[model samples]
Target: MLEVLNNDWKRLLEEKMYLCVSIALTICSIVAAIVLTNTMQTKGNIAMVVTDQSANTSLSKKFSSSPYFHVSKMKKAPLESDMVQNRYDAIVTMKEDGSYNIKTIKSDDMKKMIVGALNNPDSYVPSNDKDREIGTNIMGYMMMFVLIQGLFYARFFAKDKEEHIIKRVVTSPIAFRKYLFGHATFILGMIFAPTFAVILIAKILGVAIGFSLLTYALLIAVLSILATAFALFLNSFFCVADTANMIGTATITLTTILAGSFYSFTKKESVLDKLVHLLPQKDFINYVNALEKGHLSRNIELQFIYVLVISAIFFLIAVMKTKRDYVYR
Candidate 1:
């Protein structure tokens, strides 16, 4: 097993395709981080018009003092169209009766920050928790990428058969199980080593590396293993690599989207949220968020464990299905 794993690693390192893909993924992740940070920073700066004389005085002082808030005071009441046209974050109108009306001109970060500040903090929560939970979510998304790549790798199995490499390996001392495991080992190394390097860079740069590194490591490992099992299962079932790739890509993409990798489905009380709960990504994000808030829910743990169990089941199915054929072809 060790020999097989080492050989697989060596093969992957020699492959230019692996290196190129890793570099591309790293660039994309960095770009995403930059965009998210800038968006958050821009949102923190908001322009507001004070309506109530007393509230205006209090708010002006508060916004001026807080680093998160950028306040602009306007003397006259601006029309809604004017506020929108002028690109003001929000407009505050002070009524003669001492009441106040706050209107958001846009839905940018500035508007969100202003709303958060004006509304009760307890009543209005920002998706900034999603920001904190991003590290975990990124890890999960990467695992999905790994799984997709693993499925792509399954195509190589058929190629090897076409080239008679499977027969040559079968005739050698390499056991069928060892050969499959060797391939899986290689795939895992390809998926994880550079990913961990990225995580290390993120930590050095002062990103809040989550509370339990071990838990995260475990989660990623489990997901990767599941991906490997899925690859093996596809290889066992399909004669053509294209079929496996198409099916794998579609399935993984759908699951990740449903899991809320792009936009969170949890905020919506629609059918999507209920459907997404069955997937691991949403539950994993929820778990990470709970951990960030210093609260861990049993349900979250159960959901994670459920995903692990499903992974195990997939692995078992793959092993059973593939055990009959020692030859890769």
Candidate 2:
């Protein structure tokens, strides 16, 4: 196994495609992190159009003092049409009763900061759950990226089999187990370097890419292993490269969709949610959410272990099937 792994490592290093893909993925991750961080920071800057100029003085003063809120005053009462047309993050209108009607038009982050500032228990203010939900949705998008990338890498295994490279390797003195292990190891190592690079870039940019390095590393390692295992299983079962490719793509797409890659699947309570809970990415996202909330626990550690176990089980099944097919054929 060690020999096979060494050979595979050497082969992988020699492959230009592997290096190109790694560099491309790293660049994509960095770009995404930058875009998200900028969007979030810009959203923190609140632009309020006050209906009553009189109300603007106190609110502007109060909001300007807040680190979360950047208060900008509009010249007049902003029309609904204007709100839609303008870049103002939110529009505030004062009523005769001294209450305010706030309309968030651009970014929810701005809305939340304004609402939180206004509704401080020290001050009589109403809470805005809408912005909170929007923040959660933004986070959901990032999680989706992870799932999409996982699926992208998974398809590579199918491609390898279709190219007859995996079959050729199986005929080599290298045990099938070692070949599989090497494949998984290569992917796991490749994923971590890029993951850490993105995290480090985010930190440098002052984005709160907040997660314990150890936990994040473990989560990514397990995810990479799971992706490789599933890809191998697909490769073993499918006869043609085209069929493997289609099935691999479909499987990853469906799994990601079910895992809340594009949106929060948990928002809708259903059997689908329960089913998605069994997926590795779902557990990973849960752990990330816990980390964001500063609630890391033994349960997260157990989940990481669970992912690794699942990967091993899938790999084992793939090996057995591959071996049987080789023997019979």
Candidate 3:
């Protein structure tokens, strides 16, 4: 294992593309989070357009002064066009009789905020959805990066197999078990390095991550192990790099979706919701969120255990398959 790690470290130092990509991705993630947080901080702007020339009144004044809206006046004729283009969250048109009509493309929540703000201006507080938005985006992309890294590992394994490198290594003085361990460790290191770097970069950019750096580092380590093991397991079924990549990518994509990387699937009680608890990404992300709040729950340990167990099972199966098929006396 040490031998493989040493060799991998040297190889990594010599190859700079992975490092470049990792840094680029980290910068992009931080930039995206900043833009998204700002958008959330501002909330949605409600546009007011008065059709009647004499309809300027206290209602428009109230909307302009409200904390929830950034009011803009436009001719009422362009309301539908502006809304379709997402130019405004909502539009208010005043009638000459002091009555008004409201049209909005805003979500129900934003609509409620507008109504609430108008009813009692002093009681209205601006909504801050930055935390939730940032959380979802970070969790989703982190899992995506991990899963794609697994696919890359699978390709690497397949390449070694195709080139008869694994056979040669097994026939060498180095023990097969040590080589396998070293190989897995190397892959995990690759995944963890990029993942941790991205988080640190985001933190440096003033993006609020829920967990402390140390906690996130630990979580990333666990995720890396799971990703590497799963990749090895998938590679066990194929001798060709292309075949393994196809299978690994498809498998990872399906499992990722099931794991709720894109959205929460555990909101309602259902078979899928209950069953997805077995997925590592879902559990890991949830655990990270909890830790961000500075509380460690039983679920955190459960997720850690599940990932370790699944990784062990997959790696053992992969090793056994390799011993049976590739390694020879």
Candidate 4:
């Protein structure tokens, strides 16, 4: 496996274009995610229509001064459409007693911050993740790029089959399983380095790239492993790189979109929703969103487990198919 790994690295010298483009696209997408997120006004935009005029002026003047929130007094309750458009993050309505009612398109998590802000003028720290998830958007854009990069890297495995390189390994001291494992390791390592680099650079730049560096690495590593497994599975079924790639691109684009990689995925009582749930990307993205709100139990790690199981399933199918086709035959 080590020799196989080394040999593949040397082969990559002749295939640098794919590798370089993968890195370039990954970086470009990260930048785009950041730009799009920042361009949208978010987080601090609040419309306060307190029923008590005295409390209204006082609280608005108070919390608005805090950096974490901006309080704009409204003549009436702000429209839900304004909230949908992100013009207002939330609407605060205070009673004569000074107690308040809050409404927003976002979750209750932001409400806690609002209440705390009203209670203490000095309370402005981010209670959890920032209202806009810079990190989530970056990873969201990344899903499509990394998945395709996996198919490109796995082309090496298909190249071996087409060139009869595996026949030599079959009769050599190396078992077929090791050869397959070697290919997977090489693909995983190659994909991880560039992906991890994006997170490292973001952290260094002090960008709100969402999660901690360790967390990003864990997520990327798991995603990379899944990509490698998917690539291997596709290549096993179709040894010709072109054929595998054509099928992979179409399949990945459609599924990733359906998984709602870019936008929100709506669920309904239909077979389509069930199909979307079966997609690993859907669960992966949902888990990320869940983590941001602190509703996620870190101990459970159920979503990660599900993704890993899918990866294993892909790898097993690839191994079983190849063993039957090339080794047993």
**lDDT digits (tens) for residues 222-298 of candidate 4:** 88998999999999998688999999989999999888788642435556777788889887876776665566776
lDDT of 2: 0.58
Candidates 3 and 4 compared by lDDT, better number:
4
Per-candidate TM equals: 0.65, 0.60, 0.67, 0.72
Q: How does residue 187 of candidate 1 score in lDDT?
A: 63
Candidate 2 Cα outliers beyond 4 Å, as residue runs:
1-18, 37-171, 204-207, 296-305, 327-329
Per-residue lDDT of candidate 1, residues 14-64 (tens digit): 766856775466546544744564455433334455544644454455544
Pairs that collide in candidate 1 are 43-109, 43-110, 51-94
Report how far residue 187 has shifted in candidate 1, in Å: 1.5
- Taking every candidate in turn, the Cα RMSD to the unseen true structure, in Å, is 7.3, 7.1, 5.9, 7.1
Clash totals for all candidate models: 3, 1, 1, 0
- Candidate 2 Cα RMSD after full superposition onto the native fold (Å): 7.1
Clashing residue pairs in candidate 3, if any? 210-292
Q: Quick one: best TM-score, which candidate? A: 4
Query: Per-residue lDDT for 1-329 in model 2, tens only?
Result: 56655655566556667456655655565455546644643334345545454445565546545555455665465566654544455666544344666876444444555677765624634333322232233334444344334444444455556666667766788777776666666556665667666666656777655455565566555555676677667667875656775666677767766675443424335566677878876766566566556566998867656767787887888778877876345
Candidate 1 residue 175 Cα shift, in angstroms, is 2.4
